[model samples]
Target: MRISRRLRPRSLRTRLVLIATVLATSAVLVCQAAGLTVMRSWLTDQIDERLTDFRPPSPVYRDVADGNGLDHRARTDDVLPSDYRVFFYGANGRLLSESLGRSDGEPRLPHTAAALKLWNGRPTTVPAETGDGSWRVVADSGSDGMRAVVALPLDTVEGATSKLLWFSLAIGTVVAAAVMVLGSVAVRLGLRPLNRVEDTARRITHGELALSVTETSPDTEVGRLGIAFNTMLDQLRAALHRKDAFERRLRRFMADAGHELRTPLTSIQGFSELLLQQPAMAPLQRNEAHELIARNADRMSRLVDDLLMLAQIGDTPAIRRELVDLLSLAADGVTATALRHPDRDIRLVPLADEDTTPGELDVVEALGDPHQLAQVIGNLLANACTHTPSDTRIEVRVGTVRTGPRAGGTDRAGRTSAAGPMTPGIPASVIEVADDGPGLAADDAHQVFERFYRACHTGAVEAQPGSGLGLAIASTIAEAHGGRLELDTGTGEGCTFRLLVPETTAPKGHTR
Candidate 1:
């Protein structure tokens, strides 16, 4: 195990090549072993055939000739070769004629007891080793009480097998080397996409999210991974963009809050200082200074209250939801605003034809926090009253919008439609407060709902003093109730603020 670990390659490509080479070598060795076994078996079979075909001289020749007869010598010479040896023995196991002349090193074959016992002309073959080399021998006995044995040397088979083994080793070595080289190249090419992914990851770590991997085929593993990675990068970039936008809004809010607070604080401080330095000033001046200081103090208090309310709204504000009558709420808002500015012309127009009377109750109901919803309406009314002139007409239209209008149309009072058609999914109760005073410019209309944002009326009449958080608060409240507040206004057409809230039916026996 330790040696294997030491030999293991560090790189994946090298490891793949090493594994391929090992498998190939093992296959080659198996095939070579099979071939060698077959070759050895065939060579042994040829030797056995030669041994089976061997014959001895007839016993009749022995009666007419001596031990060194010409016929016996001729028979032995015909059957034996230089590398083959033949021996003859009598039935009693006595010495007889033998081939393998003494001048040829006189190599003898080992006697096999089992083969020697064979008789009846049936030959038996056996393997034996002698001083010269290994050999295959066949022994048989004739009816004349003579036994003959023939042997063939096995050096040729052994030599051929040895040469084949060397040849296979050389071939296997060359093939293994080639596989290693080619396999490494293939692995490197296959893993090239992964390398690209690593490079992209490195760049992303340095905050370069713009870099993306190019996918070659969606079906491949590497291509799918690249696609998923690109999707993740897109999501991360979007999140970062949202964070940046939120940061900008936060900075702006801080600057605006500071500026708004500074105004009231400066006024309060100046007035208080004037009163302190001039203790014996005129009675009228002293009274005026006290009143101014009190007014600035109130302004500062209201500013702080608005800021705190905005902070609360920024959090998840707990809402006490109940069925609310939007039409009744609008009427209350208009009455309250009229009481504040008695000379301002404020009219309440109910879009619901059934809600014709001013005292109609629960004509348009919705589910929300009654108090917050009322506050939303009151803020819109107050904003309209404050921005418009005393004689400029202001209209409060309360209605349940089931479907949108087909085309633009004017109301009985010639006011354009402020709220468009209701959104498709949910029924909504819309309240629009439109004023005929100088409308907000295009830029101001967009920013009117921003915290502490006041429009700059260039070369026009001054707007009423305000903390500029009313519309922002109203918009937040609307959103909390799964609704939205929108604006419809152009430069010369006057401004309209529309609040749409999802409508809900009142429960049985519920009264407002």
Candidate 2:
């Protein structure tokens, strides 16, 4: 088995060439054998026909009957070839007189009754009278009561057949060699594309990830193979790019998280050390230090909680799904924000296309985790309230917008269409939290949903700095529920955050 495997052709081109050569050689050999057989048969038949047609003169027969032997100078000798022989036999099947062909000595003759019977009246092959070679002979009884045998030597026929056999073998050898050589060349040309594929693979192994197969015709086997290879390469490159981006984002997130945690830890450590060293300090100063430490601790705790929540949302699809009313969630967020910042004008407003007033807005319902959606609304409201001045007016609007395949046109608030809905043409619920405040800069706007990203306001002072994870957590939760959190904002024009989720479609005559 090992030897056979080692002897087998390893390359595709070599195997193809070898197979073609073998088939051609086989065909040539079969033709050679067939030609040899037919030629030998035809030559032997001609020799038999000549022996049967030839007849000796009367003198030769008469002399042979009288035991005078054959007449060498008979006129019939000129009509017959020198290789023909005549033998005279008695009635008792005893050889009496004979004529030798060109060969010396007496030729082998069939003298016995059984031999004469077998060779009578038809040509048959038998050993020569000289016991040297074979002859084609016929036996017959003459009218003079004498029996005669005529024979022909087979040397000429065999000699011609031998020459033809040798010629055919020579021709077959040349044909096989030409087939091998030409077949090898044809196979090499046919496999050129495969050779290119091999070279491309070698280069890719050496780290050329951007390379793609260019012979994508789809008309031949090799062309189709090239097309598949190109597709696989494209997908591989895309996956690698995504992996690289994810790694970079993770590294940045780690660094920012460490920095955020370190700040609060440092403040807590400093305040505890102060209390330890100054036990007799003034009550007011000590109380202020305690308050500062508590505030920092609370910020650190909230940051940790937000980080945990983001991780959960990113790593799993285990959100508690239920039908959620976006209008009610927005109203609740407005009430909570108003209590937190009573100086700010925070209200729930109707969208431009809503037929009813703000207080009677439609129940914009969707399928999602209620707690997570509520958190998203609360975070958007809190983000607006924290970033802008106390006099800024914040508006929360809720409505259903067309989404999904064939979804087009603007929403009620004159915004571009979102993605298609859960059920083909059904609309998706959207909650927009808009604030007329000092909006984020163009650069900061893009990275607002990134972990630990905080925008700086130039002309306003915040009542308290946040942990910078509210928007990030909100985005993560929205994605986990198969929804998206999009922001529409510009410098000085204020900011608006849109939360769009797939709406639940109920059966006709039923409400969800």
Candidate 3:
């Protein structure tokens, strides 16, 4: 086993060639063996027929038989060639006459009683041995009770078989070698694509992801493999890019969080030191310092809480899903905002008749964590109230979207329309918070939902009290419930924050 393993070909091409050669050679050898067997059998059959015909003295043999002495007839060399020998044996197993007399004066047929009885006037072929070689002999007896035997040498058949064997071996060897060489070449060509794949892999391992295998056909094995490999590479590259982006976001978040926290911490520390050092300070000064410390501490605490919430949302948030009435939720958000800013005009427009009544709104439900969804609405309202002037008009529109945006529909001048029929899927609930205030610039509109991103302002209302995470958290919460938060804003026009959440038919107690 060890020796066979050692002799086995290592390369696929070599192994394929070896296998082809072995199978071809085996087939050739089997055919040659069968052919040789058939040829030898045919030749022996011809020799047997000749021997049987000679038993009843042919014309040549009869002519020789007319001679007076048996010796004279046997010695008629013209009648029989050297390859043919004839002999006569008496009933007592003694040699009577001989043609082509023995070299050492010994009888060609072995003297045995069984042999003499077997040859009693019956024609049969048998094998006999002489000093020279083996022979096939047919023996019979004439009316005079003398056994006549005709023999033919086996050398002719053996010589022909030997030549055929050598010729087959030579031809088979040449064919097998040719097959090996040609098979190796074919195998190499077939596996060339795999070699290219290996090279591509090596390049990818070295960080060269742009290289790809050229796929010529999708039906062939190598082509399919190339296509699959390229797809895998594409996925790998995309995953790596996502990883890099996530890391960058993480780093920037840490830096921004640290900076935001440091300000309140500095204020708290300074005010506390001031209060401690001035024991005889006035009551008003002491009260002012205490208030400042408490306010800054509260600010820091809110920042920390928001940071923790963001982290928790980054992981899979434990969302308790249940049926939620989006209109009722929007009404609650608007009520809360009105109480906080009573001077602002906040309008609640019911885009659908179902949103006009509380009972109807209850029927139009969405599946989500109600608390998170409410927080998203509350955050949008708070962002609008904080960014706009005290008298700016804020509108909260609630409706059910039976279909999504049409293929070529436009949203111009704050108006939207559908060009196609409603899609056959779950309906979505949309809530838009639009405010006529100092709207976001084009650049700020895109980065509004990014963590720690803030817009630039240049007036007295520029100082916005925010950690820049409210919109980001709202967007995250919206996505967690399989929804999205979108924004539309233009300079001096207004800003509209649209939140679309897919409505569900789950029972009131459904949880996920």
Best by lDDT: 2
TM-score of each: 0.72, 0.81, 0.81
Model 2: lowest-lDDT 10 consecutive positions: 412-421
Sorted on lDDT, highest at the top, how do the candidates line up? Answer: 2, 3, 1
Residues 1-512 of candidate 2: C-alpha lDDT, one tens digit per residue: 99999998898878887788778877887888898889878888898788778766666667666766544545556655777777777656677745635544344655564566654557888775665667788776664766777788787777877788888878878887887889888888888888898899789979997787777889989889999999999898899999999899989989999999999999999999999999998999999999999999999999899888887887885468777777788888899888888888987875545344446466666777889899989999888888888788888977666654223222332222122224445456778888888887767887788788888876565787788889888777766776667676677888888876765664111111
True lDDT of residue 37, candidate 3:
94
RMSD to true structure for each model, in Å: 6.7, 4.7, 5.6
Position 497, candidate 1: lDDT: 79
| Best of the candidates, TM-score | 3
Distance (Å) between predicted and true CA of 234, model 2? Answer: 2.0
Q: What is the model-wide C-alpha lDDT for candidate 3?
A: 0.71
Judge candidate 3 at residue 175 and give its lDDT: 85
Model 3 pairs in collision: none
lDDT of each: 0.71, 0.75, 0.71
User: How well is each residue in 1-512 modelled by candidate 1, as lDDT tens digits?
Assistant: 99999886798777778889999988998899899999999998887776677555564236323455444555555544556665656555564544432223332433443435554334344444335446666665655566556666677888998999999999899889888888888888998998899798899899887888786469999999998988888899899999999999999989988998898789889988888899999999999988988887888898898888777766866457877877778888889889988888999875535424553434777888888888888988887766666668998887655423321121222223222334554556777788887887767776888888877643333343788899888888877777777777777788877777765673221121
